[model samples]
Target: MHLHPQKSLYDLAQQHHLEGLTLPSLLALTKEQEGYSIDKAKRFLAFQGRINNEMLNHQVIIQNPYTAWFEQGDQNPAQIKAFIIQFSVFSNQFLIAQLHKMIHADTLESMHASKEILANEIGVRFQSGQQHENLNNQSSTEGSIDGSRFSFSAAHFEWLYIIAKKLGLSFAEIGQPKHGTHATLFFCNELIRLYGGDNYQISQAASYAVENWAAAGFWKQLIQGLQKYNDQTGLDLPLGFFIWHDKLEAQHAAHTQEELEELYFTQNLDEDAFIQNGNEMLAGVAAFWDGLEVQRQELATTH
Candidate 1:
């Protein structure tokens, strides 16, 4: 649905003549934690990526060189309806599920903790943007090919530890989340925004940091989280993991390409569109997450 200038989502629904699909259309989905596991998250990410590709393809399909809506008055109603569904809430729904997989609980907990300590190290409040000159010099810089990553400033590790403590995820067996330089940097920048810190804004550099540093952590968490989720959900996650690992190994041995193309489309993405869509998807899904409050609370309580 087209986002109206007045900022209501319903206007487009009416324009499309679909009564059930509105700005506030409710999804027939649940957010129960009993159903949570790493495997489910991974599988869903894979699924949403497919849907995301479909929507992106549709954007290409909907190209209109003509200047006016009136010029396209003869456009199919079904086509317009499909556009509404794709661009509106459905996209958000798909994204939310996909994010739960991408943003692992372990990473969140770790990053949160890391941010807190980093704040102390930098002598700024948590989520503040002041770069600690001393700490910056101390932290060894790491990077990926995109060159978006910066050193995980000393303050960040401190922040992560604190956040992990806040979430009660510090048990030795549970372990702190694995993170790299870029993820550490961007997460802190985002957390500043997320926690309502001063005017610390996200930048294109921050976006690049996220894309560059987060992949390994995400895949690692996806594997471990799915394993635990399998045990909780009574799923064959163990068996799945076994086969998945085996296949990856076998494929590595068999394939002539040193790197697997399927692992990532790395260095080949339209970075602007990729970052914009990824972040927008997160923002859109976040709007609907309040409805999942009950289930989320229950999950929190049980844990």
Candidate 2:
């Protein structure tokens, strides 16, 4: 894949005659938003750091039932089954579905698109790989460094399936599917679809805030819990979803921050827009974690 020099988003919008496109922006900032002030940006980034940590602190995944279960080395099959249901649905499938959608938007019609238009889209997958090292042997056009390989989302599903099978729970019995929190995450999904072709807009809110902050923290606790669950239960189930993310998502998140910071320095990012959407993204995810807590509490009361 040929890498092109970066172009201003303003210029790309002008060139594509897409300035009049009516997609609702997450940032809701004035179009005349000026270059980012490093001092202000640093402060806001720090604020995001605090908010991210706080959201994790509030998650039920980090609370008593899970903590008590892990500490006591509980192996109640019913308890393990209930936890897996919430874990698979809200944490794994929901998050991966959103990512798959965003990745599709980024990679669609990519062959004819300019590097400037497709850079971030490809960068996301490249840093993570196509989930297939085999792609490295293919031609550039067929399997470019940042091009599609195996479906990352499919891998997540496989993880869910393996866990369900190990616990002797059919896919149907994980737990009652809850929509209250997922509905909020679905809103974030719509945002990815809304900004489908605009990698800059989609990534600003979706990748940075959602993937880097929300998913990162959620997964950290989740992976640990699953490991402990595995030890106590002796299920030895495949947990590639957790393992895969635990290893690579941090690298992806860091790369995203560096890329965004570079964009800020180049006056390509709108400060107000990023901050507004970043906050929204974080809140949406925080609610997602809250939903997991609700599911846990429901299990507690019923069990």
Note the clash tally of each candidate: 21, 0
Can you give the lDDT of residue 162 in candidate 1? 36
Best by TM-score: 2
Model 2 lDDT tens row, 102-198: 4555445433333322432222233333334331221112223345444433344455666788888786664234522464455445444432335
Which parts of model 1 are misplaced by more than 4 Å?
1-48, 51-117, 120-137, 140-277, 281-303
lDDT scores for all predictions?
0.30, 0.48
Q: Which sections of candidate 2 miss by over 4 Å?
A: 1-79, 90-154, 172-199, 214-217, 301-303
CA RMSD per model (angstroms): 24.7, 11.1
Clashes of 2: 0
lDDT score at residue 62, model 2, on the 0-100 scale: 41
TM-score of each: 0.19, 0.55
